[model samples]
Target chain A: MKTTRRTTILLALVLLALPLAAFAASPSDAGTRWLHVRVVDRSDDGESVRVNLPLDLIASILPEIDIEPHIKDGRVTLAPEQGVQLGDLRAVWAQLRQAADGEYVRVEAGDGNVVVRKAGTLLEIDVQDGPEGAEKVRVRAPLAVLDALFSAPEGEIDLAAAITALAEAGIEDLVQVEDGESSVRIWIDDRPEAP
Target chain B: MPRPRVTLAAVLVATLLLTAGGVVVLAAAEVWRAGTFVLSVRDEGPNGARVAVVVPGIVATLAAVAIPFMLPDEAAARIRPAAPAMRALASELAGLPDAVYVAVEAPGERVLIASRGGVLVIEVDDGPDHVRLAIPLHAARRVLRSVAFAAQRTR
Candidate 1:
């Protein structure tokens, strides 16, 4: 009985110490996640191309960010904002074709806004900040976009050429074309698209 | 004998678990600035036989964190594949041909691209903002021959 009791006490002590031991054993954040983006292709009209993004993968790309979900057919649907819209796609492309350095474009969709930097690929879209009735939750695109863009045939089409093309496609005034290497942005006003 | 084997296996498992835990703690210490350090000294017998032990347990831990910044990177020209799976999927998503690219070890990821044309096989290991691409085996052979020729000329 005494031996059993001693063994029981020892086991209990070990159980209690398990967490501390484990804590002492491992470090935190051994693995890390990073944001990625890529381009798929040029649209049929050389306008905007469809991008493939997985919601979970996209969500993991950004650290310390929250995204909202929507209810559809009694199921949850995550909405990720793709910066492209009809009007910005039209005007930005034309201006981009002739835009000099230090120019930017701004695009507004409903209450949401997206800014494009000159000659850069990333479209910084703002989903928050809207009126009480506006749908301004939060969203992010997938890192797969980066994967595709970087892997594409980078032979003749340099990063600047791609950003210029995106601008000339009427992306928006808020959208800026940025320098590929220098990371300088060109800002523009958000203009209303023609109906 | 059976009990001894079981005990040995348990000890081995315990050692492995401890090693893995130590690795994780070290990695966490890198990103979060949190870690536990232990130092001990022991003296035994009449003359005081001394011993010292440090907790980090691995020499590589210090070097892995330090070397990246200290050395200058030599810019060598090379063409390499980057993000084969993402590239394949993006191509398919953008109306390119559908292909399958396997993740090899990470089966949990649902997205993959593969092709069977036997013309060019590409593999992409994707990371945040960076990717590693591997060329097809046939291409590797051709590249190897060219590298051999270059080495011969240098020699």
Candidate 2:
């Protein structure tokens, strides 16, 4: 009778533990999945705008700002913690101000790409992938347009400082700044991975 | 001569009533649900919009009430064949009390399956080469999460 009771208890324990085990195993057992996003400039004008980024990279970076991200079927979904919206925006703006030293403009992200455009009345911004792997950013807007937008009282807008701040925020790496007569373009290449 | 103010007021009121009646008749012919979201689609143009609203649970209950009365006869016939399959699918989704309600629309014959939680998955009938997606409740939650994020960011 003791042995029968012991066997029944063991069976019940095993049944109880089964669900817990399954729950723990699901996420990792799903294996490695890749999410790719591509953006094309479908405008008639020769406005060169192209961006590519992996969704997993964004998912990993979201936690720094206290956002829980979930990716399913190539869509990156994020749920911000309650009351973190305004706080996050303020913190982000403050960080940008400090980094730019009053040379900050507008930053936008859409279709899985972060775009920093010429801060002008007209909408002019360069589209590029977020800092992950070897990605490149090409800004086709002219310097005059950008300069006109950046009407600073004291000094000119420092692109290097702005780019560095963006990189630190896990946005992108500014590799080379190309200056042209018509357009001053900056190429943001992905930073080399650490071993 | 005295101004015909009373006659004008009567004419205006009659016109307004006729317009309201016409709108009601047209609305009855279409599929509309006021739940966590408001979804209204016209049968003629197949043009529709879904907008999220506050008090989704109450809205969903109200939608449940209005669905039967509003569903046109043609839509009712089209929905009959897909009803069983939709019920089975809704039952498969956890946390849903009732089987998914199927609403059909003419002009290419579209099918909208809505759960008790105001989650809708639409299917379009395109001859033999057709595709239908059954989005789970979790997927709907994910969508809502994204919208919430957007709202936060905008704020």
Specify the highest-lDDT model's number.
2
Candidate 2 local lDDT, residue B22: 60
Q: What is candidate 2's CA lDDT for residue A88?
A: 51
TM, every model: 0.18, 0.22
Candidate 1 wrong stretches, greater than 4 Å: A1-54, A62-195, B1-63, B71-155
- For all the predictions, what are the DockQ values? 0.01, 0.01
Q: Which digits, one per residue and each the tens of the lDDT, describe model 1 over residues B82-140?
A: 12222232222222122332323222212223423222223333222112222232232
Q: Is the docking of candidate 1 incorrect, acceptable, medium or high quality?
A: incorrect
Question: How do the residues A1-195 of candidate 1 rate in per-residue lDDT, one tens digit apiece?
Answer: 566556555655565467567666532221212112221223342211112222222232222121223321112222225333424433444455455543264666665565444344333343333553243322222222322223223121122222323333333232222222111122221221111
Q: What is candidate 2's lDDT per residue for A1-195, written digit by digit as tens?
A: 566556555555565455445434422212212221222323343223222222233333322222123322122233354323533543553454334222234454543344553333222334444344124445433333233323222222223232223333332222322222122223333321110
Q: How far in Å is the alpha carbon of A79 misplaced in model 1?
A: 20
Query: Relative to the true structure, how large is the alpha-carbon lDDT of every model?
Result: 0.32, 0.36
Backbone clash total, candidate 1 = 55
Q: State the weakest 10-residue window (summed lDDT) of model 2 chain B.
A: B146-155
Q: Kindly report the interface RMSD of candidate 2, rounded to 1 decimal.
A: 29.7
